[model samples]
Target chain A: MITLTLLLISLLNGGLAALIFFRGLKNKANFFFFLTLVATFFWIFGLGMFRMSSFENGIYWATLFYISASFCITYFLYFALFFDNKNIGKINFLNHLLIHSPNIITIIILLANFHFIKDYSLEPWGKSIKLGPAYFFYVTHIVSYMGYAIFAIIKRFRNVSGIEKTQLKFIVFGTITASIFALAFNLFLPFYTYQFVWIGPYSLIIMVVAITYAITKHHLMGIKTITSEILVGLLLSILFVNIFFNDNNLWFKIIIFLVAILIGYFLIRSVFKEVRQREHIEKLMKMRSEFLDIASHQLKTPISVIMGTASMFREGSIGKLPKEQQKKFVENIYRKSVKLSGIVRDILSASEFDTEKFSLPEGRLEPVDLEKLLIKIKDDSKEEADEKGLELNFIKTRAKISPIISDEFYLTQAIANIVDNAIKYTKAGRIDIMLDEDEKEVIVKVKDTGVGIPNEDKSRMFGKFERARNARDMYTDGSGLGLFISKEIIDAHSEASIKFNSEENKGTEFIITFQT
Target chain B: MAKILLIEDDNDQILLYHTVFKMNGFNIISAIDGKIGLDRAKNEHPDLIILDLNMEEMSGEEVIKRLKKNPETKNIPVIILTNMDKRKFQSQMLELGAEYFWEKTVVMPPDVVKKVRDFLEKNKIK
Candidate 1:
């Protein structure tokens, strides 16, 4: 009965350790836990078999039991010493040597038949071994390790306050309960009366329950993802353990093994796939938030200027000046308005792509009036050219031009972007616009005598977030989105295209062809 | 006269503000960005600061954090004037010890000056 109970406890403990090993391999504490549990499994399994075996079989089982017990005690000390992830224990090489010396020596003595236990007899449910001369020394060494673990845990408990204290509460309860029961059965009762060694292993199950509850429920030791993995691992453990311990035919066992391996491989692969996908999603979310921050700031800068100038005009601050000075303020507000509206449209366009909401309002796309659009772009950008002490003018090269089918607002934006780029690049010369048309297409060209696009920059000049070398050097804060947005808007119409001709540091002209 | 330090980068907003604040006969100091703003705050010892949240060099949140940490400038009242969405940072700015928050898109130059005057009066009352 006692031997069977020990075997049951060993199986249960080993199952719990296997469950933790799924996704818990990254954690140091879990590694130590695996070591301690495996040692316990071997110790209990060997000891249980020893008590039920014949005399010759008893010696073989006893050898395994004693060796496994040494491993159990050594690893248990290591686990207790470093259970808390934050606390670095004072155990050194010398300390480790001192702690496990007695365990190592006793195991060697017992297994080598050097008489750590002279004789033993089966007591129906347990074993009775006649203690040798070295037995008292071994007891003191093991007891010291237990005392050391208890003292360390209590000291840590006293130092921590709040949630950590609560986690330690579980650990303290488990360690003390296991120790007291193990002592009562293995040491005190065995010396004075019949051995009840099976009681020690059973009480350890309570320790396992408390610690597992702490790990999963309280989130101690940061054991995340192990909960769901445990659910998957538990079912697999039962299935696999049954196949492992079954005394079936060799052919049946091999078939079961093959099937189990196939299922386990796919199960592990799926879990990792989920983990990778989650990490990728989190990275994308972080980048999107950063972009939004920059977008908000970009939108805010021009809006503040537009609103401030408009507010100034509304309050008669600019109108109170002479008519000559007053016209400049109105021009300033108009210039700010064009930049403000252009930025807003760009953001809206980009967000549609980002959020996958390609919802454009109906009837917004219509025949764009070529003459009025060019006049407005020239008027709005007049102040921008004047601010830089340059002349901006528009000329119609043809008597009549056909209107183009496009979104008027976006068409106005694309023309404004071309003119804005002219104003930005031209340092000391005039920006001129010439409009002409043939039977099939209407053309708009903006020419500037300023630093032109380099040969390398012209290819990706219209790509999103790409800027010319001189443009970025001249203006530090430009978003490089103006031309990109304009290109996207023009490209949406199948027959519209933009072309440019440039000589570096001399002059450049941009031509937009809209098929009527 | 309460010396007000206006930390803003936009040239048009700066011109509008200079006109408004000067018309009201209040002394004003302007810093174009956060790095200059922080330096001027420590050296000028302005009675109040008007801070814009987003800037090229350093952010207004970082400026406020440094100001609160420096004992010499920690007591000066702050008025947050920004065009960034106000709801996102209103409570956090208040908790960071800003005296008033105004969205520049909504508040006009006259009302902003009036707010400065009103905030000074209420602070005197407290």
Candidate 2:
């Protein structure tokens, strides 16, 4: 029974390691996965020899333990290389030495142990061997091997980013559990043999579980799933484990088996549902990333063309025109320049947001005359408003000059965006810009008599690339980043807020309130 | 005028290239994809091929392979224009007979045009 169990455990370890090796080979040539296979092969060989009923040599067990220790050491080195993202070529010589050096040492040690590890006998469960002082070397080697793996894992954990760190943590935990079980079994085997044999297999199982999860879910080595049948197999294994281990009595085992079948059905169903949800999310994210990449590239071309053409025209490379025509050309250039700048800004902002690196720099907070700034903006918007046949007016209730401490450029840009949106959306009606001052705050309200926002789309109006349903129809050319940027600027100030009031076809009012 | 073949998928990019090349007095033959670009290179026999790495059909690498394979187009120096910053791909392209690999983000369109002109002038292939 003990021999059968050992064989089963060895088979499992060998099978898992082989699968990982093949999977790694399919993806690319990964040294760590290859090392894992080597380690598992040695382990399986050791276990197979140790479980043999006809085996009577103590040197055989010692050799098995030595090989296992050597494998463990190589495993640590491989794992370290993997975590560091170091190329295999960098340490090829050292890796070759380490992998081969043990075999040479083990052979020499076994040859010398001809007289040392002599006594061997068959116990009730299986064959047993009395260990020598040389066996301590094997124990020491295994311990040191585990120590290195732990050290590498801990050292690299602080620096590795994203999913790698999570995967490493899982690996560390699994290895630690396996190591502890091995250590316990090694130490207690002399006192009680069969008691801790199961620990090794159990720990191996944990390692398998952890590695399988990392490979399938985390894409730790980029091993893509080949079939859904594997998932089905895993479900069946779960059912088997539940049925086999959950009950003590035979009749209860049968009852539990039946119940486990039902549970397994639900479990499999839930697993599929979970997989589908995860896949859907992954697909959406992938599409979103692809869309962002393509859209940015696509948008860049036209912006580049406009900017390049404008620069060429401005430089008189396209030939000079009359003064009146020049003025008209400059105006056209200015309009195209603004549009290109806005698109470029949006693209940059979106990239920054994606990378989570966007920040508003601190600016000098000495504000100039508000009235002057408003007049300048109104003059800028006049041509745009005139083109659309919309009246743009700035109404000041109080003429009192109050200077606010804020970044003037951001304030101007924010106000300009609101005004630009008003001009773009309002076709026939007038745009009213009202300034009001209180004891604590200065309020700037830009209200436009245009096609108003729908109630359903109002909530997401400030989101990036989200245009109101009515606004989208009215102004099809807008990039939908203005409101999002406006919101960001407002949030950055921490003392400003934007509120809106609107009705369909009546108008929309964006009230920007800033602390004095 | 130096004959230049521009392999670009984006319509706007192609237009930009055409305008720039026309302004700079280069005879430009453009292709929308790599396969067409290769065909144009074989038929038109351009002095140099300005290849964009990423395209909808037939990548720049595929075009480079084809160019290197065909005796007629093999001598035409290929310049790779790409957004990818991967060193491995760059080395692979270099090994596969790309004369120069320039990142689009790092090198402006005008600079690229200038480089092409310089290559033509240096080779004296006009």
Candidate 3:
């Protein structure tokens, strides 16, 4: 019965190690944890074999168990150092060698069949071993290493909170309790009472169970899906094994196996689908909160201006003012109100893309004048461009460009967003707008000599509430929804595409192509 | 009349504050951005400074940090007028040694002038 429990613990450790290592292969902490689990499997399995082995084979089994224990403790210490995503300072080769020298010496002594163990005797309850000079060395290594590992975890626990704190609580509790059991039963009791050596390996189950619970319940390493799938696979394999080896009716066994396979298929599919939905919701919630933060700040600026200007007029407290000055302040209030409305329109237009039944109203679509629209956009942006000392140029092609059937309002907003982005980013250089056409396509390009988007920022350029690092540094007031809304508007039109080519510190050019 | 320095990037805001402060019997000094604001704070030595938080070239946070660092400008009281949420930035602005934080959306120009008058009178400034 004890042997069966040992085999079960070994299988659990091996399965969990494989599942986590394969799932989180790139994580440094996961790799160390995998090594620790693998080492524990061998330690527990070797201990079980040592209990069952004959007198002559007893020495060999004892050596295997001791070697595995040495490796297990070493790996556990490394795992603890890296646990909870903790870094232990700069890693020098000499420092690593110094840290690992004790384990290396213990393994070498065991491998040479030298001094760690002098004699072994088997009894009904457990096994006993006589101590050699190196036995004290092994004892000191185990006690100090395990003690330090627990201490490291406690240190980390003090520094971290939230879900990480809870995960560490499980880890620290399991490790401390398991180490206490192993020390009392496997080392101290074995030295004095000459029994319960087998209990050390059994105590490891507490650690494994605790970590497995953390993996499934707390999403440790965020490997919940992998653990669920592996568990399902393990159960299905056991059912199939019973079917093939049992002496039950052949047809009944076959039907039960097929049913199990069907159940496993749906089980695995639901787990994957649920996890993916959860991840997507998490990403969207984060984006929405960020958008709210930026949008509130943007909205308040215009609102404040309008409120202050209106309040000044209503109070009539500033004494007599010239009519021209009053007109200017009123104009300022009017311009700010217009800007506030524009911000509202942009936000609404962007939110439309988030809805399920998003479609442009049929009445809004019409044949838009391509040349006239570009000229108007250029004229409107000229004042802002001139304010920043940038020469805004428009190059009109001599060839007649044909108009496209589209929503003129949305199309103009989209094109103007790109133009506005150019003026906002360009600190010193000029912006050029051009309109050209071939036989089947109308091409409009807006180019600027500004801080260009880098390769790292390119992937998320059109994502909601995202800004390039350089752009955020240059201007703090952008809504970050402009490009996303622009892209969506352009994509809504049939056979239309928007693309950009940019180099950092040189410039960016956005090209919009529409099927003519 | 107490001299008031307005460090604001928005032209409309500068005009509004300038007119209101002038009409309220105070001399107004204006800087369009933080770099110019810091220079004016050093040279003009305005009795009280009204600083806008976000600006091109240099941020108001950097301006206040530099102001506190400089022996000449450290004593001049600064009131942060910004569109940022007061709850989020009030404690931080205080820690940076500003005398007060006023949210632009919440306070009208008249209210601001009144506050400035009260502050100057309480401090017994000319």
Candidate 4:
């Protein structure tokens, strides 16, 4: 009964460790967890050997398993610390070595055949070891290490909320239950009575089951796909084991093995593909909701302006006797309507990028005059810059610049977006829109003496709906899709590229280059 | 006539509010940005200030915080007229001692004048 139970515990722990390690190979927490379970597996299996061995050999097996127990407790502590994606570098190497010093010293004493265990005596029920001077050391080591693991988890539990809090909750419950029972049955109870030593190993099942539940239910390590994958793998392994034990001929066995291998490969592949698709769909849903949030705010402003101005005209509330005032109100409505349409067009253009079959629309490509296009952008952005009391300059090249074959509408929109961003971010300094060219390329550089992009924000600047922290604080109304849409539009044009150089609190320069 | 300060960066919004307030027989002074708005609030001593949140040089929140901190401009009621989500800023604005937090898109210019008129009457600010 003892042998079979130990074998079951070892198998269970080994399987779990393998599954978690394989699925989350890159995660430090998973790696430490793998070590913890492997240590537990070794300790339990060693305990079984200690039970079956003779008096002399029983002492050796006892010492070996005690060493494994020490490692098991230490690894459990490491796993708890590393869990929740905490970076390993946070605990420096010297501190790590300091943490494991006691374990290391205990391992050395056990290996050197010190007075850790005085003797081993065989009895009717089981074999047990007599306590030595180092026995107190071993007991203290196990109790304190296990206690600290639980304590660390409880400490982390207070700082977290939501899913992480729940994840930590299960870990705390499992580790505390398993540690208490294991200490009572395996560590303390064994000193007084040997009858319940086996119960300590069985208590580990509670820990395993709790963590497995957490993994399958919560997004612990982002491996919720582990459940089905492990099931399919276990089922296939059982089929392979059954084939090996069959009374079939050698050739029959070989053929069955080949077919099983082929089936298993495709089954796992399909499961992986399905999980990936589900994750992708989930990401799209999150993006759509975020889009709607910003869309409502941006779209509402212009609509509000149009509706408010138009309503005042309609109601004639203050008695509109002056024709000049009426004309101004009419113009405001027209301007706001045009602004509303422009916002809607930007949103539509941004959504088009989400579709898989998206490409620049045909027949929209035409030879666009660089000078004419740029002057229009300057004229359009002048009112906004002038309102902020900043000079907007368009410096034309001395040499005549030729036009490029491109989508005239999108190209203009992309360039205009850059200039608009410049005006938005800048407070006082002048924005210089300089057009220059060489034999290979035509370049338009929009430079501003505004608050420049931070180093951390530069890489993700062109990502959809991603705004820098400073930018978000500075301007609350930006949808953060301007640069993303601009990049896409520029990339759509063959041999065209957009790049920028920015220094925080200094300025930013965006250069768009086109093939002549 | 109550001297009203309109602190908005948008020209069209400024125009709409300016014309409405003028027609309603209120003396309206306008500032193009938050910095100018703060200066006007302290210097002009307007009875009520209509502030826009997002601006280039300074923000409306900063303006309000400064106004409430200074003795000269602290008593004047500030009305936040913004295109931002009202739910996110309504409580925050009120906590900062703003008299009213109104979404620009939701309230008409005439409605804003009436709100201002009602607030001035209730507060007994001449």
Please give the RMSD to the true structure for each candidate, in Å: 14.5, 21.8, 8.2, 7.1
- Best candidate according to DockQ: 3
Clashes of 4: 0
DockQ, structure candidate 2: 0.04
For the second chain, the TM-scores of the candidates in order are 0.95, 0.94, 0.97, 0.98
Query: What do the candidate models score in CA lDDT, each in turn?
Result: 0.75, 0.68, 0.82, 0.81
Q: After superposition, how far is residue A183 of candidate 3 from its true place, in Å?
A: 25
Q: Give the per-residue lDDT of model 1 (tens digit) for A1-516.
A: 576667667766765666556545554555766887898788778877776677668778867866776667667667666764335645678877876787778777876678567677766645567666666666776677777767766776788899878877876898679877876776556555446656677888888788778877785323335544455545545554455354677567667656765675566556656765777687768756765765676776777766777777788666666787667666667767766677777777766645553323457777777888899889878867887899898999988888777777777777788888888888889899889998888999989998899876899887655679887666544666677777776777768888899999988998989887
Share of native C-alpha contacts between chains A and B (below 8 angstroms) recovered by candidate 3: 0.69
Q: List the residue pairs that clash in candidate 3.
A: none
Q: Write the per-residue lDDT of candidate 3 for residues B66-121, one digit (tens) a residue.
A: 99899999999999999987888889989999999999988899999999899988
Clashing pairs in 2: none
Alpha carbon lDDT at A150, candidate 3: 78
The DockQ values of the predictions, listed in order, are: 0.37, 0.04, 0.58, 0.43
Give the per-residue lDDT of model 2 (tens digit) for B6-42: 9987565576567667778889989988888988999
User: Per-residue lDDT for A82-191 in model 3, tens only?
Assistant: 87344455568998798788878987888885777777666676666887788889989989988888787778788998987887777677777887898888777867
Question: Which window of 10 residues has the lowest lDDT sum in candidate 3 chain A?
Answer: A237-246
Worst-scoring 10-residue span by lDDT in model 1 chain A: A220-229
Q: How well does candidate 4 score on lDDT at residue A450?
A: 94
Question: On TM-score, who's better, 1 or 3?
Answer: 3
Task: Arrange candidates by lDDT, descending.
Answer: 3, 4, 1, 2
